[model samples]
Target: MTPPVPSVPPASQPVFPLPCGMVLRPWREADAGVLVAAYEDPGIRHWNRPEPETPDSAVARIRRWHGRWSEGGAAMWALGRPGPDPAVGLVGLGDIDRRGGSAEFLYWLLPEGRGHGAMEQAVRAVSHWAFTDAGLHRLRICHSVANPASCAVATRAGFLLEGTMRGALLHADGFHDEHLHARLATDGPVLAEPAPGS
Candidate 1:
């Protein structure tokens, strides 16, 4: 028989702070509308094709992420400043392989939230937590090679480019090559965030 997933302590979600009035916090039911709206972006929908139909269904999806967290399966975080409406994006881990001591990291931000280095900082914070707090040894991230912005983020977060997997990811348009980037617990700190106004 297969052994059960390891027990990480049952706890509240963590909020990681970033500079310039940005933070990464837990997702809430109220954030469903933002999620729905973000997905409605043609770019987002083209890349991420999960369909649950409406904002209400999006809440179910968020709850499902929390369920995975409770089971020590993955950790998910929402991005925004601390306020009534705090979900501008999401960053999370998936396919956590305990036996392999690794997990796949993913993230997305609304168009308005772009320009600032928030995503890079968020990714670095999450990687550190996964290595130190979560006791995971390796984290891997991959994005469509066509998405240079994502590739830049992964590199800035100190994920080393392993290689390109030909046509590894599919979107609304078609298949695209994926660039694999990974970081190990023993790896050095991630690339430094750019100074404000750079």
Candidate 2:
């Protein structure tokens, strides 16, 4: 189904700052290598099932992400600290149904980006933007049931567990049950702290 026109215009995606010097910003061509590297990590590969990526394919993927934003179907961001070799992770809203006031969250972090609560912070930041700035009323975070880390992130971000979907995602290992978690605009605040400049 078609999403309604996005409240956040395509030309102006906002950057959100997290604690400890991280930020969620739009992906750049220079980030293609990082995307390729993420796909190389066993943990990410096992969970995300990314196609083998050459630099060209990674750049194409980044451009497609930009197009999705322009089409008002998604908003994707690269997670990183400012400086050389910035993006170490990715987080975003996908499958957005703006008319229905809903979207799904997607994310992953590299080894360097892990263990710092960055994923949880990124989720909260994106959820805040989805609800407040994007005019979305509901957001979902669904992951393979085996992915307890994702479950924790979703829960910490205030997305209540709704239920499990049988065989919802097919991983390289096999079909896996998926846990569905959701949060509403009216839900109590889950942010550990206000987003920068909030």
Stretches off by above 4 angstroms in model 2 are 1-10, 194-198
Lowest summed lDDT window (length 10), candidate 2: 189-198
Clashing pairs in 2: none
| Model 1 lDDT on a 0 to 1 scale | 0.81
Q: What does candidate 1's lDDT look like per residue over 63-103, in tens digits?
A: 99889988778888998877777588888898887766789
What alpha-carbon RMSD in Å does predicted model 2 have with respect to the real structure?
A: 3.7
Best-fitting candidate, measured by TM-score?
Answer: 2
**Can you list the residue pairs that collide in candidate 1?**
none
Encode model 2's per-residue lDDT on 1-198: one tens digit a residue: 675654854487888889857999999999999988988999999887778999999999999999999888999999999765669999999998877888999899999998778888889988888877788988999999999988988887778999999998899989999999999989977566633432
